[model samples]
Target: MALRTLFADPMLRMLVAAVLLAALLPARGEARDTAQLVANAAVFLLFLLNGLRIARRDVLAGLANWRFLLPLILFVFGAMALLGLGLNALSEPLLPPAIALGFLYLGALPSTVQSATSYASLGGGNLALSVVSAALLNIVGVFVTVPVFLLLGGSGQGAVGSAVIAKILLLLVLPFVIGQALQTAAHSFTARYRHNIVWVDRMAIAIAVYVAFSGAVEQGIWTRVAPQAWAALLGLVAVMLLLAHGGAWLTGGMLGLPRADRVSFLFAGAQKSAAVGAPLATILFAPEAAGFIVVPLLLYHLIQLVVAAPLASRLAQHPAGDGDCTAPTTTATDRSAPPR
Candidate 1:
């Protein structure tokens, strides 16, 4: 039963399998180039599909929930960034500077679209607000994050940030817009086959993860950091997530938000975008250091999944009062499972 549950989530299994595959057969020589090409293509398709999956109704509804939306957005971009900078500063003497910088980058990223909204739905939250806020952040984050990184004195500063932004426009944003445009033409087909797209999304992300870990492996990523450093990174991420979630809950309470909106706020405000973060790290950071920088984001992504799944489940078990956005009649499923 334990093993069955462990393998229940296809995405989680794929993630673990990808890491192991990278460890055993890290890409080299010509294969590395091919892998890069595949990863890039996968990312483009992933975003495009994401675009197609989004609905205009969600955006309009999200606008209506501005009170909840605004605070969550501020938390994602502003508070998280500042908190990371401060933590990095305080821990500078103890941890590697790269790891510190990694935390900062992680904080600066936008909230995830699919995962945040999915978890929100699962937790009996305001799905419309969650989806809308998440979509808006990704769109804005493309422009905002790089400049913020520069302001924080991130390495490769202007030049690297510029390259990342350009790539974001061409690869990420454009495909998404194109997908959105094609949605109307493909509506019937997409509606029929929407469920299948989820696997494609999972596969694309898994491919990206494999290529990233392979690059890191080639750079001797495992050799560079000690076990103690790994533990420290984990602890720091846990604290940050806890603080972010607590703040979101408190902020929603102060604003007199409904239970559903508060649930949406917690997930949206606390979650970071691994989908964007992982690919962007490759372009922004040097090859040798990209893996280390990605460590925090990767770990945090997995940790959030583990932590959110149970909480969402628990939250769903409770009843919502008046004015609460009814959790979608269809349940949201966890795409990933924790390692056994």
Candidate 2:
């Protein structure tokens, strides 16, 4: 019953299982190369589905809330920046330099879409706001995160250039555009079939996680990370989540956002995107070091879900005050239908 309850969230079950599977029986030789290709294709398809589902009007509605949006963005990006810098300063003693860089990399990532909105909706937050905020952050993240990464990473200027941006455009942006165009062409079909269509994104994420973890295992990633470091990373993840949620709550109060809007702000601004982070890490870090860089992200992903699950349940008990949330949004009922 306990295990069943824990696995109730398909996202959590799949991600945790993928990591364990990769750790125990990593792909090798030709299989490894093949897996990487599959992961890449899956990522592209995932974004393509994203394009198909996200309505432009929803984004526009979110954009209208400039006062609420601006400070939220600053809190998400700026606060993470400060946290990453502090972690970087202290992590050298606790973690490998490359892994330390991973925490910084994790900090620079955009907010999650599927998971964040799911939790926000569950928690009686402004689901539309969560969706739009997540969409906007990712769109900007492709351009902004690279520079933030390079600036925070403080190394390998040559690693990031137009080529990396080109990859993001090709792999992430193009498919989304095609999907969006398709949505425009067939709005009814897209809406009717979204539940079925979301499998593509979920599969893509699973494959990507498998491939990333497999590669890391092959590179002795587990051997390099001591038990203490793992414990520290876990603790750090908890602390980060707490600080992010608390900070967002406080910011929302200061901005005088309504309860529902505050809930959206807290949930959406606090979570990071593992889906985008995995593929981007492959491009940014050395192949051998990529796994270590992903470690913090993986931990962050799992920890957020664990922390937010009960919080969402608790928040749901309160009455969600209606405010100015008019945009169409996703909810837990359509788990497999939205892009993350």
- Among these predictions, the greatest TM-score belongs to 2
Clashes of each: 0, 0
The TM-scores, one per candidate, come to 0.85, 0.87
Model 2, 1-340: lDDT tens digits are 3244346667666778878998999877899888877877887888887777778887688789898778877876778866866776678789877777776777778888878888889878888788898888876676677778777754541256677678778888898889877878878877788777766666677777777778779988878889998888777777777777777777776777888888888787889988788876765655566667788888888777666666676667645444433222233432222124
Local distance difference test values of all predictions, in order? 0.74, 0.74
Clashing pairs in 1: none
Query: Listing every candidate in turn, what is its Cα RMSD in Å to the true structure after a full C-alpha superposition?
Result: 4.9, 5.3
lDDT, residue 184, candidate 2? 83
- Predicted candidate 1 versus true structure: per-residue lDDT over 222-307, tens digit per residue: 77767887788788888887776777666766667888878888788888887778766655665556656767787787777766
Candidate 2: where are CA atoms >4 Å away?
Answer: 1-5, 154-158, 318-340
Worst 10 residues of 1 by lDDT: 327-336
